[model samples]
Target chain A: MASYLPTPDLSHLKSADYHNVYEPAEDSFLLLDALELEAPFLNDQLQPRWCLEVGAGSGIVSTFLAGQVLGSRAVDFGTCFVVTDLNPRALPVTQATWARNGLALHRLHCIQTDFIRGWRPAAQGFDVLVFNPPYVVTSPEEVGSQPRGRGGIDGRQVIDQFLPIVPTILSDRGVFYLVLIEQNRPQEIISIMRDQYGLLGSIVAQRKAGIEYLYIVKFSRDTSTT
Target chain B: MRLLTHNMLQCHVKSCNDPALNFPLQFQEVELEQIEAEENEALLLNLVGKIDWPALVQTTSELGITGLPPTKPDVVKNDPALMKRLHEILLETNVAQGKMVCRGCGHSYPIKDGIPNMLLAEHEI
Candidate 1:
C-alpha cells in the first residue's frame, strides 16, 4: 500500500504583510453604501464638481469615482477626488484598481498620509469630503496599526483629529459625509463641528448594522452666519 | 524616495533647530519619464498639505528641471494655468536616475528607474 501523505497548506503565507487582510465583501459593501449617499449629493448638484475620500484603503471608492468622472456618460462638467491613506503599500494597488476598471488615470490622485496627525488637502478645501473612518470602539491593542478597522481606544481618535481641520479644509458650502459605528459619540462629533468649527451639520443617513448604527453626516458653512 | 531623504526634507529645514542630522539630501537610481496630461486642479490643491513643495522645488532644481509653478494659486477653482503647472510638478517630473543623500544623517538611498529603494540597514532598522 502506498503511504498516505498530505500537502502542506501554504495559503497562510502571502508575500506581503498588510495591516488587514482584504475582505472584498465588506469593502464593496462599504463602497456601495457610501456611494449611495454621495451619488445623490452629486446628482442633485449639491457640490458636484470635486470630491475627496479619506481612508481610501484598497482604492475601491477611488476607482468607482474615476469611472463616474471619466466615463463616456459623465454627469457633471468634471469630477475628481484625492484618495488618502496611511499605508504606503495601498498606493499602487489603488492606482492599479483605477487602471483595471478602465477609468481615466487622471481623475484620481493617491496620497499616503496619517490622518491621526491631521491632513491638509493639496487643494485648500473640497466640495465634498467622503470619509469611512475606522470606528471599531475597542482597546488600543484591538485597534493598533491595522489601517482599515482600527480606531484609537474609543474609536473617536481619528474622528477627533479630523474635526478641528474641518474649517481649514472644506469649501464654504461644502459637506462632509461620514459613516460611524453606533457606539461612536455621534453627538460629540456634531457638536464639535457646530460649536467649534462653526458649521451647520446634520445626520442625513443612518442604518443599523447589528448593534452598531452607521451614519452619514452633511455639514455646510453658511457665510451669512459667519 | 529614501525614508532618509523624506526625513531630511522638512519645511523647517531652512532653519534647523537641533537633531538636524537628516537635513537636505537623499538618493535613488531610477528612470525619469514625463507624461503630459491634464492637471486635475482639485487634486493638486488637495495635495498641498501632503507635499513638501519647497523641498520638491529645490530637489527638482538640483536635477536641472524647472517644472513646478513659481506661484501657488489663492484659489484653485477651475484654474487651467495652475492646473497645468501642478500637472508638471506632480506627474510629469520623475525622480528616475540618482541616489538621494541626507544632508544631515549622511544616509544614502539608491533608486532604480523611477522607483525608490527605501530599505534600511539592519542596524538602522
Candidate 2:
C-alpha cells in the first residue's frame, strides 16, 4: 500500500510515559489509516472546525490528524484539536507528542474529563471525533484495574456508554470514527447508532492485525432523514 | 486551556443546570502566557459564527484583558488588525496554571501545565 501521508513522530514518548499513557499500537495506526481514507471528504467537504479524540492516550491519533490529515492534506490550520483522557498522566504525554511533532499549539488543547461531559462545544459541535476504545474483552474486575486496557464483557463497556452520546456530541456535518475488535459486535453497534440515534453507521474498513480482527466504524449525520 | 476551549466549558455537575450559573467557568489565580502561532483569518471568521460573544467579553473583562469590544467585532472587515488581536486572545493566550470555579456549584477544576482537569468526584458526578 502506498502511504500518502507520513506517520506522526511519537518518538518523544519515553518508556516511562507508557506506564500511564497507552502506547500507540496496531489499533491506533488503523484509526489513522481510516481517517486518511476520508481526508478528501474531511478537508474538502466537511472542513471541521472542532475535532476531538475522546480517549487520546499517547495522543498519537490526534497528532496524526493535526500534522498529517488536517495540516498537510489541506490548509485548515484553524481547526481546533481537543484531546481528553480520564488518566491524568495521559494529558501531558499527549501534549508532548503534539509538541515534539512540531504542531502549532494554538489549535491543540487538552482536558481531563470523563467522556463529553467536560466538553462544551457550541452549535458547530465536534465536526470530527475519534475514539479507539479498549476493546480487549475481560472480566468486570479487570476493567477496574485497566480502564483503557480491557472492556468489560465483549469490550463494550466504554463503547456502549460512548455510543449514545455520539449524536449529541457531533455537529450536523460531523463524522465520528470508532475502532473495535471482533468481540465488540460491530454490526450491532452500527444498528444501534442508526436506529436509536438517527446516525448512519457503517464499517469503513476492517483488517486483521495479529489475532485481533480490527474494525473501523464510522457514523455521520443521516442527511436522508431531514 | 486556551480561551477558546475555556469558552465552551461549563459546570456539568449533575445538579447544576442553570445556564447562567453553569457556563463561563470563572478563572482564578491563573498563570497566563502568550504562545504565538500563525494567524488564520479564515479560522477567525469561521469561529465568529459559533463563539459565544457575550461569554467571551465577560471572560476577557474578568481576566483583565482589555481593548475588546463588548460585542463581536467585524473580523471580516477590510482591517486585518482585529483578526490578529482576536487570534492572539482566543487562540494564543494560554491558561497555564489555575483553577476554574463554577459559579453555580462552587466546584473548582484545576489547571496545571496548560491542561485543565474537569473530572469531578463521584459525588459530584
True contacts kept of each: 0.03, 0.72
Cα miss at B92, model 1 (Å)?
A: 3.1
Q: A199 in model 2: Cα distance from truth in Å?
A: 1.1
Query: How would you encode candidate 1's per-residue C-alpha lDDT over A28-146 as one tens digit per residue?
Result: 35445555546655556654455677766666665555464233323234555566665556656666666666655555555444441212233345777767777777776776435
What docking grade does candidate 1 earn? incorrect
Given candidate 1, what's the lDDT at residue B4? 13
Model 2 per-residue lDDT tens digits across residues A108-223:
77888887676664543788999988788989777732335678898888788888888888888889999999999999998888889989888887889899999999999889
Residue-level lDDT for A81 in candidate 2: 77
Tell me how many clashing residue pairs each candidate has: 31, 0
Candidate 1 regions with alpha-carbon error over 4 angstroms: A1-31, A43-50, A69-80, A116-123, B1-31, B36-60, B66-90, B95-125
How does residue A187 of candidate 2 score in lDDT? 90
Real A-B contacts recovered, model 1: 0.03
